[model samples]
Target: MASPDLIEQRQYAEAVLGGLNIRPFRVDLTDGLLFVPKSRIAVVRKLCKHFDWPFKVTALTSSS
Candidate 1:
C-alpha cells in the first residue's frame, strides 16, 4: 500500500487524516511533511502503519 506518487500520497494522507480527525497545522509539500497536533502523534503513527507509509516524527517547539 505504499504510495508511489506524490499527488496520490497527498490525497491519501488528506483522506485518512481527515477521517481520523488529525488536522495538520501546516503542510510542507516541498518536504512532504505534515505538522499535526502533538497529542495526535499516536494516531498518526497508526495511520501510517495501516497505510504502509513510511513516516518519521520530529518534535517541534509549539503548542498542541
Candidate 2:
C-alpha cells in the first residue's frame, strides 16, 4: 500500500509533469524515484534543472 505522503507526492509530480505533457511511467515513492520513457529523459532533466530538483539516471539490469 502507498503511504499518504507518497500518494500526495505522486499526485503533485503527476500534476507538474502533466502540465509539461510529460507522463511518468512509474513513481517509486519508497525509493524516491520517478521513471519516465527513455525519450523523455532530456526534457525531464531540463525541467529538473529549472526546478532545481535532483535528477539522476540509473540503468536497470535484469537482476534489478
lDDT digits (tens) for residues 29-49 of candidate 2: 667666777778777767656
> In model 1, what is the error at residue 24, expressed in angstroms?
3.9
Where is model 1 more than 4 Å wrong at Cα? 1-4, 54-64
Clashes of 2: 0
Pairs with backbone N, CA or C atoms under 3 Å apart (clashes), candidate 2:
none
- Poorest lDDT segment (10 consecutive residues) of candidate 2: 55-64
| Per-residue lDDT value at 38 in model 1 | 78
TM-score of each model, paired residue for residue: 0.64, 0.56
Best candidate per TM-score, number?
1
